[model samples]
Target: MAFTGRDKTWLRGPRAVGLLAAGAAVVLGLATGGTVTQAAPAKPKPTHTQIQLLSINDFHGNLAPNPATSSSGNVNGTPAGGAEYLATQLEMLRASAKAQGQETATVAAGDLIGASPLLSAAFHDEPTIEAMNEMGLDATSVGNHEFDEGWHELLRMQKGGCLNDGDGQNNQNSCPDPKNEFKGADFEYLSANVFYENTKKTLFRPYTVKKFKDGQKVAFIGMTLENTPNIVTKSGIAGLTFTDEVATANALVPELRKQGIESIVVLLHEGGFPSDPKAYNSCPGISGPVTEIAKNLDPAIDAVLTGHTHAAYNCSINDPANKPRLVTSASSFGKIVTEVRLSIDNATHDVDRLNTLANNKIVTQDVPKDPALTKLITKYQTLVAPIESKVIGHITTPTVVRTNDDSLESPLGNLIADAQLADTSAVTNGKTPVVAFMNPGGIRGDLASNGGAVTFGQAFTVQPFNNYLVSMDMTGTQIKALLEQQFSGLNGPEAPKFKVLQVAGITYTWNPAAAAGSKVVPGSIKIAGQPLVDSTTYRIVTNNFLSDGGDGFPAFTTATDKFFGGLDIDGFANYLTAHDPYTPVATDRISIGS
Candidate 1:
């Protein structure tokens, strides 16, 4: 097989040495046979190359550490995460691997940015890209959030430049450092499945081949979830097409093999949720889209690193040939790093799957922080302090969290929905929204109060997408269809697992045992304490994301009289201000029964 591409090079030293050694052994055997008997030369040990893959996923620009007591700060009760700690962990792991005579490559699955805190998002995630470059990231796939600003911005992230709006865009500064222009990513942003519709070309390189000093090579294929368009803002990905993950990967196997690269790994932005959520190092009853993708992958692919479910699990799933293949995920927000070791047979250049081992390591804070990362954080903090510290409002509770109850409704989600409803209802001479819905995914963090006062930074962190609020008229029938969608085809076969939308000014009952499209109990939906009339038109509000049928809510797209309002975060801020010292609302809006 011929080696091609930029990294390709002839691997002749090892084979030539082996041939010379074999000839010498044959000559000695002939001489010994003609003379006195001599002990047969000991058989040579099989040659192998060791490689260490350090991986993280769904980092989401966590430049600062989550409070030690916060859920995002720890992994199974151990304090972890923060760009400083993550950088230190990666450096230490690489050093350890080097001591063991192994070559190391650092990689990520996706979601390195977007839906980020003010520190990173304020400057269009340039800080996050710089931090990732400093941490020695080799490559990463593009997550759905990466297209939040559109594919053009994603390209800018790869090939550096300031946004055309420049500084003070979106009320936040960009490329704040006058001396340093935004230099893009040092690592490759691989997008094997995403392509340009006009030219039929991949948005980024499909795969990248890395060569080691010992003449060994490994190919990494990266891709995001195929359902990206349905989840991301439709306008952002207007000219792109996301292909099927399984077919995209399997199709590349032959091409990679043609290049004589037998050792292959895939970095996928989709992942699975384990039944044992606390089992960060083990997969107990793991099931999701990733499970099926892994099972159907070409047997030639040695391992898979996944993300997007924000789960941490180390599992060995069966490949197409029914052979176990390593699959891992390092939970979101830089909380964990996965260490994978692969031993490749030098002669065949194929991975010894039986010897492959993987483990998920917490990015613990016990070690000293990486100074470079700390400096970078300090710079951004200094620049963002004024806006971040401004008081947004006060909350009666210590924290209004996004954690959902039995019916998947959260206090924070309810508050956000009410905010959107109130904002749209305040409009004069227009259709006033009677109710609102908020997707659980949009609530990124808790509303933590310091002495009952919440800061703009906290509010921004909680609702970072900056999605516009949209008010529309939906008939009672359409509303019911929207509710039924929660239990139907949002994710995959097991879609009933809490894709529920948080609601305000409405209450309804659902039957978990009922069929998917009929999960919502008939005649149970009520608006403003009145039974829903199938023909009555009700004004509803949601972020622009859902108005365009995002998150599998096609009912929102069919609504009439659509009106776009201000940013959702601004409405949330205004609501917080108007209802100072707000109390938590009961999550009894949605109920589950027979």
Candidate 2:
């Protein structure tokens, strides 16, 4: 459940690490000793010193000041997610660890790349790679978007060390050769589960053994969702196969043991819990697959660091009633960093205890930007300024994108589906530019088209996740079956959250009382103003998220000839810019006639 971009500022920041200790400082009775001296209370017993695991997730290439809504009603103004603020935060956390006689590590779960704005995506993740290096990310998992440019491009980005100027400090790696250019990453990407099916080769080192100042070794295993094939373009992962996550972790545990490392932590690329903007303590209890995965995962592994849902949580999940296996996720877009402090048992070589601490600090502009990295960002920013600032088009009216809103369809959703159908049909070299479908979950935000002009950010508010346009061939019957899956609620009782689908090239009315496949109201199905041929195979364009079965659309999973390239947002923007000053007609793409 990638968080759709929005201005939900009312939700309070999730519970941060220090808040809990502040309240419990006295209530837990740490100040009182067994024998309290009458004069000025005797000093309390010392607490166990702990190592800090610092982490941030979904830092989507925000190298400059950006607008984000705070959990409070504050608009948060233009003040979040520059690498400089992150650096300041990390530095402060490190200083605290130094005072505590413990070690601190900075890390991220995933979304290190892809869906980035023009600044980073212009060079295909180079800017992000540079920023992450400056922020000192120790290790990261292979996020689904990491495969956006394909695996080969990722390899180049990872190996192509930091960019360098003539200072001789060599802040970045200079590409050795044009063809063999390699820019090495400050950290490694761990994908312990992704493997090549034909060659049986593991994609990357499954886990990294990071050492602390005190020589304590902790193994970090990184695994993205096993459903990567469904979310990413087929061409990007043609031969590679994604195995089951739990199965992969179970197999890797023994390997870590062989390496004399048993204090294992999983930096998994998955997240859960819908955060309430109003309450800091009321984190949406873990209800997604991630919580289940955390519970069923090999308990030998100590902590699970997760991302992708873009929500926030700070409590223990799935160990016992009160004692919990620590699981936490910082909200997306540099909103927060989760700090997990683990106390390792020296003799047993295991994580003796775990505590989750969250920091909901805004990545503000108050911090001075890193000179070297800022200069680098300025260089790229200059390069991309023209295209990024270009005025694409105008919207007739504001389009909303609340999943909880059960309207007929969203204006943004219609625009995106229209582009998918049009662009994919032109590329297929086909005569009948037939059907297009856009998953509702992919339309992230609403565009306020009135009283103001639309910019890149305004347009991106509608479609931001960077999903690629995927075209597949499916029989009319199969398409109907796919629609049935959306209505069945097989995903969950709230499966309705995933039920919205925008369609083009056809119109039909649905009835809740009718049988699943036959729910289409008779005489209501229309294709090109005629009747849909049930046996005819139709060419359909949709996002890769659904083509591979994201959001439980199994019907497209079996469809063939999946074509992918430009992102869904980009395609929509291209469509808008090309056909601007647009009308706001509903277009009657799909109708639910009672």
Candidate 3:
């Protein structure tokens, strides 16, 4: 139902920035007894003011359209995302609001860069910031990936510290490189909870107050995940700390209230739900972390816009009082945009009503591409084209590496395990890496060597997530305990499942017929042709994912004396490139014996 403003907040500003209205109320009518079947008169229209809040999240450096597919007589779908298309959509939305005398404001939740395709990553996220500026994004919360290049780089992206001087597109005079004439974005990056140790002040302003034409104030409080350091590279977040989201927001609420800002919106770099694999417009079966946060938030906050899960969901969750609090998340990869209309009580200066009008529209051919942005994209694409086209190696057949594929090790997993083992051995001072373990899930896609020669892009596809390599010390018993951790399963009908590990320099056989706790066959475990030595410790090499207990592997969390190498994929790529024109040397990384 369309929102009819009753007691709505109307703020006055130079321009009506973002005007959001509340949802409509249920009209009640009196009726006589005896099953009266008379049609009730329509309720009078509400006179409350309305406004539009336009938001996007988890864009993740998708400055161009992604490859899309449709089958079974599905409608024609174009590559969905592009800065030009997003700009067009925002402009059109703003125009519609202007016609209705409403205000519009655009914001993003975060994860603007990092783990991006080569196009954005190669330039250290400068391209993404440029695209975001062109698309007119006003502000965003810092995502974990924002720390991919570390806090200093994040600051540079925000303030154009790294761009060349005299870049015309941004603040013309402020560009770092005068000759190149590159521009920077004109937006604020907020971080309410992220802070430095000594000063204890937020890295950036905790929130920014956006004043509207009607003299109302809307405060956007932005923050990233509290466990950011755990997810991002440690060096990137040096001397920085992330506090709990709830604690941070709660602390800021009273301060915002003191400033006469009653309407509060949280732009957080986290989300809930997953989109249907068959359709980006809808999340078929997924509920993520955002719901939990929304449910527990203080009522002073009106709404929350979230991202990170890359799922789209438009649904209202109940508050503590059982009243509905509208919550929504649009899918990532620029697949869709979420528009929320909010209504605030004029007298109370609080959000009393809200209308959720989310349209996860497919960016199709019908929406003509913006020529200017397309040209910029082409320039960057050309720059990375050579790297993408370079032949890396060949895969004679499909090599699987999904964590939970099976008890048996996958060929790709074996290859990565060998690489890690060899690299770790080469690095140790005298003591060689006797064994190496690679997390299965870290190996994203398969190597279809039979199809054609593997290129850099193909290698990227094989191991997409930018996980780094780490070496840690573990006693022989600790290693066994780690292996045992993977064997343990959650106890329940719908318990969590575990993914198998791919190990090199070690061989172990497990019998499915054996009891759950005794699955490993006796005398079937060996490392470097020696019986497993419980008293001896070993130096192991693996990815950051395993070190962090991702994929339900808690054993890795116990690894000590950790060393963080650079990017894991870089290590793999360097290994492959050095051994050019490679072929798979299938070794029994794992063996299941009777």
Top lDDT hit: 1
lDDT of each: 0.81, 0.61, 0.62
* lDDT for each residue of candidate 2 in 1-594, tens digit (9 for 90 to 100): 111111111111111111000000000001121211012122222343356777777766656545445331121344456666667777777778768777766667888787765566545567678777777677787788888767876776667643343321211123312354335576677676677765445576666676654446777777788777766666677767777777777666676677677677788887666445323222443466575676566756777777777666654454323234556666666656665566666665666543223334455556666676777777766666554555678766554343332335666667676777667423564533478887776665566554545666556656656567777688877877776676664543454253757877777777656655555677676766777677888877777767777676778888877666566767777777876766555646555555
TM-score of 2: 0.79
Using TM-score, give the best candidate's number: 1
TM-score, cand. 3: 0.79
Off-target runs (Cα >4 Å) in candidate 1 are 1-46, 164-166, 169-171, 424-429, 491-493, 591-594
Tens digits of lDDT, candidate 3, 1-594: 111122223222111111111111110112221111112232222444455777888777878665465121122344566677776777787788779777776788888787676667656667788788777677778888788767887888876655443332211123222455444557778887787765556677677766665566788778787767655656677788777777677667776787788888888887655444444433344355565666566667767777776665555554444555555565676766776655555566666533323444554444766676787788777766765677766554454343333475776777777777766423545555678887664664665443556676667656656667778888877777666555564311232334567788888877656655566777677888888888888878887767766545566777777776666666676667666555665546455667
Clashing pairs for model 1 are none
Candidate 1 accuracy as lDDT:
0.81
> How many pairs collide in each candidate, listed in order?
0, 17, 39
